[model samples]
Target: MHLRKVYTIARHEYTVTVRRPGFIVLTATVPVLGLVVAVLVLVAGRGLLAQVDTLVGAMEKPIGVVDKSGYFSPVLPAFADDFQRYEDETEVYRAVDEGRLQAAIVIPPDYVQTGRVYVYSPQNVFQRVSLEDSHRLRAFLAVHLSRPWVPEEVLVRLSEPLVTLTPVASRQETAGPWASFTQVLVPYMVAILLVISVFASSGYLIQGLAEEKENRLVEIIISSVTPMEWFVGKVVGLGAAGLTQMGIWMLTSLALSGGAMLALVAVSPIPWYRWGLFLLYYALGYALYAVLQAGLGALGTSTRETQQIAGLASVVAFVPFMLSGLVFTVPDAPLVRGLSYFPLTAPTMMIFRLAVFSVPTVDVVVSLTLLVVSIPVAGWIGAKLFRLGILFYGKRPSLAEIWYALRSA
Candidate 1:
C-alpha cells in the first residue's frame, strides 16, 4: 500500500463529503432539535406536576358536614377552619352548590355503631380527587381518631418508612434508579449512534465507489493506485468525517445542555475504562463495516442497487440494537453472551454489558480478540471483491463468481 496515494485519496474523499449540503444541515440541526425537545419535555413535566399539586391543594378546602349522629361534632373542632358543621343535609347541599364548600360529608345517626360515612359533591368536581388526595384525607382522619387512643410516635412508626436500602455484594454498591436508567439509556443511545454513524459514513464510501464505476472514473483511477490503497483511503477519509460529525454533535450537546449532560455522566455507573473500550470497539466495528460496504459498492453498477445492499447490511448491524432491552435486563444471558462474540453484534452488545453489568474479564478479552481477528479477515475479503468487481460493469457478480474472485484475486 502506498501511503502518499492513500492519504491523497482519503483527503479528497473527506473534502467532498464534509462539503456536502446534507452533512451541513444534519450537523447543524441535530443540536437545535435536541434542545427544543428537552425544553418541551421539561415544560410539560413541570406543568403536570403543578396540576397535580393544585388538585391536592384544592382538596384541602373546608368541607360542610351534617352530623345527625353528633359523635363527630366533638372531634370536628380539631380540624378548625377546614371543618363546618351543619344541622341539616339541605344546608350542606346548599353550601356545596354555592361553591362555599368543596364537598359535603354526611354522618348517619348510627355512625357510632356502623362506621359508614357518605360524601357529596358535583360530579365534575368530585372526579378530580386523586389517589394522593384520598391518602392525605385518610391519614388526617386516622391521626385525629387515633390521637384519642394511639400514641403519635406509634402512628409514625406504623407508617411506611421513608428510608431505602441498597445492597452491595462487592465494593461497589448497586446503582441507584437514576444511575441504572442512565446506564441503560446511555448504552442504547451509544449503540444507535454507532450504528447510524457507521451506516451514514459507509454510505458515502458505497456511493462514491458506485458513482466512480458508473462514471467510468474507477478505470482511470485504479491505473495509478492499487485497489487496496484506494479502499483504505476511502475508509480512512469517510471514517474521519464520521468522527468529526459525532464530535460536533457532542460539543453541541454540551453547549446546549452542559449541566444536564454533566449530571447524567456524573451519575452514570460506567467507568472510564469502559469508555475507552467503547471507543476501541467503535473503531474496529466501523472499519469492519466500511470495508464490507466498499466491496458491496464495487459490485454494484448503480447507486440504487448499492444503497439497497447497504441498507440490508445496516439492518444486520442494527440487530444488536434490537436486542438492547434484553441486554439491559440480563447482560449475562446465554444469547446476549453469544452475540457479544459475533463480530457484527459484538461492539453494541459488549457496550451494553459493560455499561449495565459486571462482565467477566475473560469474556471481554475474548470478545475484543474475536473482533480484532475478524477485522483483517473482513478486509481481505472486501479487498478481493473490490479489486475484482471495480473493473466489471453492468451485471452484479454472483456468490459463486465472488468466491472465484476471492480465490483468484
Candidate 2:
C-alpha cells in the first residue's frame, strides 16, 4: 500500500528483467527480423516483376495464325517475325504440336463482325498467362484493325479507357482502397502487439513468482513488507519491464520504417483519436491479464505449472485474434459486438470495430468501462491468491483453498 515500497519493488523488478539476456535478445531481435522480412519481400516482389517482364519478352517467339476470316492474312506481314500466316488450321495445329510455335491464334470467319478471337496453346499454358501478354496481343490487334473509317482517337480510347469513377464521400468516411485497407490492418497490428506485450510481461511475473516461491525467497521478502505491498510492487515492476520491452521494439520499428508508418498515417482514414483510445484499452487489457496471470502464478509451485496456466490464459486471450478475420469483414455483427464487451476479447474486438467502422460511442464507452472495472477486481483476486499461496511450496494450493483464502479477512 505504501508508495515508497511499491516504487522500490517496481524498480528492482524492472532492473532485473531488463538486464536478462533473453529480454535484450527478444527486444532487439523482433525489429531486426521484421526489417529483414520486409526487405526480402520487397526484393522478391521486384524480382517477380522482372521475371514476368522476361517471360513476356520471351513470349515474342513466332506464333502461327489460321486466318479463316481472310482479313488478317494481308495485315499479318505487318506483325513481322512475331506471326506466321498459315493457310490451313491443320498446318497451324501441326506447327504448335511440333513446338515450332509457342501458340496459334484462330480468326473465325465472323471475326470482323464478332470480336471473338481464340488462342490455342499445346498445354493450356495460356490459362496461367500474364496480363502483359494479353495487353500486347490487344495492342497488336488494335493497330492492325484500325481503318480510315474509324478515327485514331476512337481506336485509342477503345483500347485503353481513360475514364475512372470514384465514389464521393464526406471528410469523415474512408475515401480509397488504401485507406480502408489501413483501417483494418492497423487495428489488427495493435491487437497483436497488445497480446504480445501482455504475454511477455505477465509470463515474467509468473516465472519470477514461481521461482521465488520455489527458492523460499518470498518468506524472507514477505517478512520485511506486507504481502499486499510485495504483490503490488512485483506487478508494477514487471509491468514496467514489459512496457520497456514493448517500447524498445516500437522504437526500433519506427527507426527502421518510420517512413512507411508515416505514409500509412497519411493515407489512413481513421482519426488519430482512435489510436489514443487504443493505447488506453491496451493498458487496461494488459492490467487485466497481468493480474490474472499473477493470481494463477500464485496458485502454482513451479515454473512449468505456472507456464501451463499462463498458456491456457493466453489461448483465451487470443480468441479475438482468431476471430479477427470475421471482425474485419463484419465489425458490427451480433457475435462480434457481443465479444467486444467480453473482458478477455474486448480489447482487440473494440479496436477492430473502431478501426473498420463507425462504431457507436455507447459501445466504446461500455466496453472501456467494463475492462477498467475488471482490472481492480482481477487484482484483488490475484492479490488474495498471492498472499495465501506465496509461502506454500512443492504442492499447488487447491481451488477450495484458494476460495477459502479469498473468503478469509
Candidate 3:
C-alpha cells in the first residue's frame, strides 16, 4: 500500500465534498436550527416553568370554603384566610358563577357535626384535589389553626396517592420533564441528520471511485497503490469532509448561545454528554456502511443506481429511528433492548435506549465492542467486493456478477 496514494485518494475525496453545496448545507443546517431553537426553548421553557410555579402557588390559595355539618363555619377562617365567607352554598355558587370566587366548598349542612365533607370548584365541581395538593393543604392548615380543623390524619386518608410514577434507571437522570423531552427529541432529529450524512459521505466515496474506474484513472491508481489504500483513503477523506460540516455547525451553535446556554445545558450532566455518545455511534455506523456503499458504488455504471442502492441501506438503517418515542414509555422492554444490538438498528436504537433507560454499563460496553468489531469485518467483505466490482460496471451487475466478483477478489 502506498501511503502517498492513499493520502491522494483521501484528499481527492475531501475536495469533492468541500465543493458540493448540497453536502455543505445538509451538515450545517440542523445545528444552526438547533442553536436557534435551543435559545428559544431555553427562554420559553424558563418562562413557562416560572409561570407554572407561580400558577401552582396561586392555585393553592383558597377561592372558596366548605362547611359540611356546620362545624367549619367558626373554624374555616383558621384554614382559609382568603376563602370568602358565605351564609349558604347558593351564595358561594353565586360568587363562583359571577366570577367573584374561583372555587367554593359545601359543608353538607352536617359536615361540622358529621364525618361527611364536600368541596366545590368551578373548574371541576366533583373533582377531588390530588394527593400531593391535599396533603400540602392539610399540612398547612394543621400548623396554622388553633382549633382542630380538617384533621391531619383524616386529610391524609382523603388524599390518595397522586401518581404511581416509577422511574426507569439510566446512567443520566432526565433533566426534569422538559429536559427529558428535549433529550429524546434531539436524537430523533440527529438520527435523520446522520442518515442523510451516511449517504452523502459514503455515496460520494462511491461516485468518486466509480468515476475513477470509468475514466481508467482507477487502473492508474491501482498501479501505484493497493486497493486497500485507495479504499481507506476515500473513506477517511470523505468522512473528514462530513466532519468539517458538522464542525461548522458546532461552532455556530456555541456562538448563537454565547456559550452560556450551552454551559448551563452541559452542566446538567444529562444531555451534555449525548454528543459524546452520539459521536461514538456515528463513527461505528459510518465505518460499517462505508465499505458496503463503496462496493456497490464500484459496481454501478450510473450515479442513479448507486444512489438507490445506498438509499435502501439508509432507509433500513433508519428503521429503528421511528422507535425513539416509543422507547420513552418502554425503554426497558425486551424488544427495544434487542434492537440496540442489531447492527442496522443499533446506532439509533441503542443510543436512544441508553439515553432513556438505565442500560447496564456492561450492556453498553458489550454492544459498543460488538459494533466496533463488526466495522472492520464488514469493511473486509466490502473490500473484496470493491476490488472485483470496480472493473465490472454497467447496468448493475446481477447477483451472479456480484457473487463472481467476491470469489475472484
Candidate 4:
C-alpha cells in the first residue's frame, strides 16, 4: 500500500464529493431548516404573547361587585379600583349589559353557611368566563377576610404561598430515578448526531464503491492501488466529509443560540474527560461500519441492492437509540450491558450510559476495547469479500462461494 496513492485517492474523493450538488445541498439542509424553524418559533411566540396581553388588558377592566356577604363590603384600598362596589345584583347586571364592566359577582348574605357566590357576565353564543377576572375576585376576598385578624406578612403568605421543589436521590452517588430531563436529553442528542454522521458517511462510501464497480473503475483503481488502500482512502475522505457536515451544524446551532448551548454543556453532568471517549467511540464506530458498508457495496450487483442490505445494518445501529427508555431507567441492566459490549451497538449505548449514570470503569474499558478490536476484524472480512466480489458480475455469488473466498483469503 503506497501512501502517495492512498493520499491521492482520498484527495480526489473528497474534492469530488464536496463539489457534488447533492453533498452541498445535504450539508446545508439541516442548518437551513433549523434556522427557519427557530425564526418561525420566535415570531409566533411574540405574536402569541401580544395576543395574550391584549386579552389580559381587556379582562383587567373594572369588575362590578355586590358583596352582601359582608366579609368584603368595604373593598380594601389595594383592590378598590379592581372591584367597583355596587348596591345590588340589579345594578351589576345593568353595568355588565352596558359594557361598563367585563364581569360582576354577587355574594349571598347566607355566605357563611352555604358558601355560594353568583358570578354574572354577558353571555355570547359560546360563553367562557374570564380566568383572570375569577382569580382577581378570589384574591380580593382572601385578603379582606383575613386582614382584620392576620398580620400583613401573614396575609401575603396566605394569599400566595411559596413552595420550593427539590429532587432527592436515595443515595449520594446515584441519580437514576432523580435524573433531570436535560441530563438524559443532552446524551440522547449526542448519540443521534454521531449515529447520523456515521451512517451518512458510510452511505457515501458505499455509493461511491457501487458506482465505481458499475463503471468497471474498480478494476483500474485496484491495479493502481491495493483494494485495502482504496478502501482506507475512501473511508478517510468520506468520514472527513461527515465531520465537515457535523461541524457546520454545530457551529450554526452555536451561532443561532449565541453560544448559550456551549454554556449549557459546560454545566452539564457529562465530565470533560468523557468527551475524549466520545470521539474515540465515534471514530472506531465509523471505521467498523465503513468496513461492513464497503463489503456490502462490493458484494452487491447494483447500487439499489447494496443500499437495501446496508439499510438493515443501519437498523442495527439504532437499536441502542430505540432502547433509550430502558437505558435511562436501568442503565446497569444485563440487556443494556450486553448492548454496550456489542460492537455495532456499543458506541451509542456507552454514550447514553455516560450521560445518565456513572458507568463503571471496567464497563467503559471493555466496551471501548471491543469497539477498538472490531474494526480490523471487520476490515479483514471486508477485504476478502471486496477482492473476490468486485470482479464477479452477471449474478451475485452464493454463500458457499463466499465462504470459499473467505477461506482462500
Q: State which candidate has the highest TM-score.
A: 1
Put the candidates in lDDT order, highest first: 2, 4, 1, 3
Global Cα RMSD, each model: 4.9, 6.1, 6.8, 5.3
Give one digit per residue, the lDDT tens place, for model 3 in 1-409: 6788788889988998788787767766877688778878898889898967855664665556555443445544334555555777787877777766656656475533453445565554223555226654454334333235657555444343354454566543444545556566666655665776686676666567667767777677677778788778887887777667756766776687688546544544345456787778877887777766776666667667667766666676777767766677888778777777777677877667655556777667767888888877767766766677665646556788778766775
lDDT of 4 by residue, 348-389 (tens): 998888876889999999998988888888888888888777
- Best-first order by TM-score: 1, 4, 2, 3
TM-score of each: 0.79, 0.76, 0.65, 0.77
Q: Name the lDDT value of residue 255 in candidate 1.
A: 81
* Model 4: pairs clashing at backbone N, Cα or C within 3 Å: none
User: Residue 86 CA error for candidate 2 (Å)?
Assistant: 14
What lDDT does the true structure give each of the candidates? 0.77, 0.79, 0.66, 0.78
Clashes of 2: 0
User: Considering summed lDDT, which 10 consecutive residues are worst modelled in model 2?
Assistant: 123-132
What is the alpha-carbon lDDT of model 1 when measured against the actual structure?
0.77
CA lDDT of 131 in candidate 4? Answer: 39
The candidate, 2 or 4, that scores higher on TM-score is 4
Model 1 lDDT-worst window of ten: 123-132
Candidate 1 lDDT by residue in tens digits, 31-141: 879889888879888988897786565566777778776555544333657667888888889888777787787878886577667788764545435422664445534
Show the colliding residue pairs in model 2.
Answer: none
Residue pairs in candidate 1 whose N, alpha carbon or C atoms collide under 3 angstroms: none
lDDT of 2 by residue, 57-160 (tens): 44656777787876665553336567788888888888877877777888898987888777777644653264226665676577556644677566556555
